[model samples]
Target: MKILLIKAARLKSSASRRHDGVMPPLGFLYLSAALKKAGYTDITLLHLALEGMGREGLERELERLKPDVVGISAMTSEAVSMHMAAACAKNGRNPLVVAGGAHPTAYVSDCLEDPNIDAVVRNEGEITFPELLAAYGRKAGFEGIKGVSYRSGGRRTDNPPREFIEDLDTLPLPDWDLAEMGRYKDFVPHSPMLYGRRYMSVFTSRGCPYRCTYCHSIFGKRFRAHSPERVLRELRILKEKYGVSNVEISDDVFNLDRARAAAVMNGVISGGLNLNIFFGNGLRAELLDEELIELFSRAGVKYVCAAIETASLRLREKIKKNADLEKLRAAVKLLVRRRIFVNGFVMMGFPDETVKEMLVTARYLWSLPIHSFLLFFCRGYAGAEMCGTLPPARRIDPKTDNTCFVPGGGCSSQPAWKLLAVKQLTTAVFYFLNPARIFRIFRDLPFRDARLFWFLFRTMSVKFFSPARR
Candidate 1:
């Protein structure tokens, strides 16, 4: 069967990009490889971001490909746009549209109610989609399909639980050939330093075993990994086959299991894959130690980022982020001593959190011996422990709560706007106040790149100065 997988762009206009036009969506590549492995090579992966494609572009592609099935991977942020695309597809060709990601998995009911979305693939789409195709083609019951929810007789039916992939290594390497990789070279992970040229992402493991209220509520608290050997095999391919010099291990929390993490590092070193590994996904601060830091350094791990979500122990507990402040400091010290780059992730605006807690968090984050840090405003996703527990009056409007709402489930409410503003400003306050931080960022470059430097400086300055404070 011909399958068309689309990776929807998160931005409505071209303003969201980082100087560069747009980058290929990685989600589509993963699904394409999975679909290809299932004997569906007649797959076309359309990246809306690179093409600057919108609903009109989606309709045009459907007309061109006439794909038998349409698959969409959307983050909560892009739900509204995804819905528009799905509606266009349905109107243009009526291809079966399926969405799977954190958004859909968490808000299955919200997704099911959407008339345009035929089915929502929950959890891991790597395994779920193939099963869905097989079941559909056989003209048998697709009801038992694991990790999938469908609408039948105007009602949403939750399927039996589909187990997580036990062996991540067995999966096919992502089909990077599907997207224009060179366009993403300059895109860095919101870091102040570093040449944005040369960027890529790879997942060394799946699942995070943390009860960090926000994380568990989004990605589930189970930590699973592809065997080290398997992980290294892909790393080799990334370097040799795909020419990816920089790779982000996009796990929720890599190194949750030290042995597995060490195994991965050992495998990469043993395989002699010459590449820079980035922990773009946050790692647990409590888990880092000298041995692991040294091992990661030896293994060519260039930059590491860990979560220091809150300085307030109370807020940390409320988020279930069982981190140790002392250990976190030691961990940062080790990385700094080794000259390895480090970044910390902090959050603010918890239910009972105060500005003092936020200030303390900032103080603690700055105290850490690290190259850079990111402070984010806490957003309560729908169906998360925090969201589910919110009082009816306090409940976020489903339309605006893009953080956890299923792709295409439109609930345009004021709360989402507030949440978005919170996220933007929290980041602004952390970095804008620290002039030394920005200078540290500028010091890395020579005077010759003044144009690019100023471009970024002005861009960031505008954001820092004019924060979306309500």
Candidate 2:
């Protein structure tokens, strides 16, 4: 069967579009590999953002390709766009539309509620998707396929949940050939501390054991990782074949298994593959130690983003973050001393959190020797612990809601506007106090690329000076 998979873009505004760059949809790449293994060779992968395609462009592609099935992967922020793509597919060629990824996995019924979407694949799609296709090929009922939700006789029928893949090493390598690697190279996602011209993202592991309130455990809390040998092989391919000099390790927790993590890093060094690495995904601060930091530096890790959600111990515990402030501070200091760039991921405007609490966390971050701070207003995503507990109206679209400019409606004790003001003030004060960070950023760029400089400047301007206050 001819199949088309689309990775939808979430940006609505022109400004947001400029800031957002397309990262390869690793999920779809794996799915493509799975399909190819299942004997479905006629598969096409389309990344709308990377291709600069809109709904009309997507419709045209659907009409031209005339595929039997179209699968769309999206995050919660891309809900509207997901529906639009599904609608376009349905109207153009009447293909069997399937929706997957974090958003659909969390809201299965909500996604299937759309008439255009024929089914929703939950969680891991590698095994379930192939089975789904087999069922469709045989013209068999989908009741037997696990981990899929579909419409049956005008009623939604959800099959039993599928188990998470225990042996991540067993999965086939992602079908990178199907992706537009050249276009991806031209318009690469911006990484704060990445050094190389050619870069790509790699996931060495799956799942996180931590129970952060704002996080969804779609992969469950059990951590399963690819063996170090398998990881090294992939790295070698990216280096030798793709000319990828820099890699963003996108593991939820890269350092979860200290020994395994160390082994992987050491293997990179031993192999003489001197690739610049950055952990754009936030790493757990409490897990870092001097030994690990040294290993990271030796492994050519240029920068690390640590999840310092909130500095207030009370708030941290309340949110079930369970992070040690002292350990986080030490980690930041050690990374800085080792000449590694440190970026702190800070969140503000919790349900009952006060402006004082938010500022306290902000002040704590500013006091640290970190190179940059990523300030985000707390968003209660679907399937997260906070989503169930928060009032329905309080739940804001994570894509459009700038808690820094508009109040996150979830807070009852604080007005949304006040929360916005605090967020803006905290950002202004932190950057204004540390002008050296600006200089350090310029010094860290591998080459004097105008695009990179413009990205940095635009990002900072939007964060500190955007007139989107509501």
Candidate 3:
């Protein structure tokens, strides 16, 4: 049987390209590997955003491929796009249309409500997706299939929850060969620090034990990681076969397991693979120590980001961040001393949080040794604990309504204009207090590559200035 997997574009127009760079869809790649391992060799992958395809182009491709099954991977922000793609793919053919990803995992009923979608896959798809395909191939009843929600006899039926995969070592390496790797290399996200080398993203672990209110959708609290040996083998494959000189570790918490993290770093160092490594996903600052810092520096880690959501201790505790300010400061200092670039990930507009409290975070950031920072308005995405407090209208489409520009919907007591002004003020203060940070950006960025520099500048500007206002 032929299978087609599509990574839906996040937004409707070309504007989505500004946000989604050459970041390959790692989730679909893993699913492809699982399908291949299950003896389903006829599989095709399509990334709409990377291919610059619109609805018409999508329909053209769907008609040409004519797969028996089409799976769409999407995030919460891509709900509309997913529906459009599904409708187009099922225009003339009767292929089974399935939706999976963070959005579907959190809002399965929302996906099943759409006429274009036949089923929604919840949680991890590596094991569940293969089982689902096999059941479809055999024409067997899906009543007993775990981790799936579908419409049955005009009623929605959700099966029992599936258990998480504990042994991550058994999973096959991601099928990068199925994707157009050359096209992705030119448009990789976070290219400034990458030094214009071919880069690939790898996940050595899944799940985070922390209770950060904003991050409860995709991966739950259970912490699972691949063994160091397995991680080394994948790295070797990337280096030898793909000629990947840079790797972006996409783990939620890279240093959660100190011993395992150290083992992976030591393995990279001992293997003589002088690859540039980056942790663009924020890591816990409190988990870092001198030993880990040294290991990272020795392993050629050039970029690190810490998730310091808020600087206000009261707000931090209220949100269950549990990050120690002292430890975070020390960690930033260590990375800076080692010449590793550091960035702080911060947020504003929490429920019942005042402008004063938000400014306190900006002030704290000003006092740190971090080279730069990203300020974001809190988004009460579905499946988050805070989403329970939101009104029905606000919860309808969080992609556009969960920003500072949305009045009273993003959990801010202030008016939309006021909240936006405060956000602008906080960003101005953070950068104004540190002129050296501007010079640092120039020094670190690859200014020689005008194309890359412009791309980074345009993306950053859009994110900073454009509020997701409906």
Candidate 4:
């Protein structure tokens, strides 16, 4: 079967790429590899953002390729483009359009409701997607396929959830040949600031054991990871086959298994990959120690982004984001001592949270021994435990809501606008009050990524000088 997989872009316009940076669509690459392994020879991968393709461009491609099946993956932010691309595929073509990725997995009914989308391959698609093709090839319906939700006679049938993949190493490496790696070399979705020109992202693991209420359950709570040996092999390919010098380890919980994490680092050093690495996905701060920090540095880890959701202990409990604040502090100190740049993720405006708690969180984040940090206004999604517990009035708007919802203060005591203003000013307070941090941020550039400095400056300036508050 002729199959076309598209990494649907989430953007207001191609010109404004700040929200969705030029990520290489690692998910689609893996899907392509999976299809190839299933003995599918006629497969094509399209990345709309990287190609600067809109409806017109897509129309031309659809006419030219005339694919039998079109699969589109989209995050919550990319819902608009996801449906749009599906509609494009349906126009004048009898191709089956399948939707996958974070948005579809969480909102299966909505995806299948659309006439453009024939089905949804929920959660992990590496195995299920190929099996789906096999069943379809035999002219069998999707009724028996686990993890598939499809439309049947005006009703949606969602099959039982698929079991998680046990051995990650069995899956082949992503099909980098299918992607426009040259375009991705110019912009990075994670770790925008890097050391070298040729850079890429690598996922060493899947799933998280922690049940952070605000996180997606796509990977499930069971932690599955590529063995350290398998990880080293992937790195060697990036270095040898693709000439990728700088790498972003973008695992959701990379350091979840401390011993395994260390083994991966040790292998990187012994393998002589010499790749400058950054922990773009936030690591659990409490898990790190002096020894692990040293190993990370030795493995060429120049930057770390820790996920410290809230500094307020009360808020942390409310959100179920358990962490040892003291241990996190020590980890930051150790990373700093190792000359590794550090960034943190902090959230504000949880349900029933007081303004004082936000100020405390901001002050704690500012006082941290790190170069930079990101302050987010907390929002919940349809599948998150927090939202499920909220009262009817406070329930998530499934059509318009996801983790990246617009800051509505989220059932908090304060107004959304006030909370946003405070959030922006909280950042201003961190930099403007401590003039030394500006210099420290510049000095702490491990990759000498000037883009980092410029990003900080632009944000601080807008918060301080912009008349309209965020």
Clashing pairs in 3: 22-187
TM-score-better candidate, 1 vs 3: 3
Error of 4 at 57 (Å): 1.9
Q: How does residue 12 of candidate 2 score in lDDT?
A: 53
- Model 1 has an lDDT value of 0.67
Model 1: how far residue 307 lies from native, Å: 0.8
Ranking by TM-score: 2, 4, 3, 1
Write model 4 residue lDDT over 1-470, tens digit each, in one string.
99999887764522235435667788888888999999997989888877878999999999999999999998866777788899999998889889999889987877887999999999999998998999888888888799999998998888999999899999999998887676775554567565225677888999988878877888888889999999999999999998987888878899989999999999988888988898877488778999999899999998889787778888888778888888899999899888788888877778778888888888788878787776665555566787676676665444443333245625555676767776677767677777777777777776556665666566566544433222
Q: Candidate 4: misplaced stretches above 4 Å?
A: 11-15, 391-406, 409-413, 449-453, 462-470
* TM-score of every model versus the real structure: 0.86, 0.94, 0.93, 0.94
Poorly placed runs, candidate 2 (over 4 Å): 14-16, 185-190, 193-196, 397-413, 445-448, 468-470
Candidate 2 per-residue lDDT, tens place, 361-454, comes to 9888878877777777777777888878888776756445323323444433577567667767877777766788666666655447776677
Worst 10 residues of 1 by lDDT: 404-413
Residue pairs of candidate 4 with colliding backbone atoms: none
Model 3 lDDT, residue 459, Cα? 49
Q: Which residue pairs overlap in candidate 1's backbone?
A: 185-197, 185-198, 186-196, 399-411, 399-412, 400-411
Report per-prediction Cα RMSD to one decimal. 4.4, 2.2, 2.4, 2.4
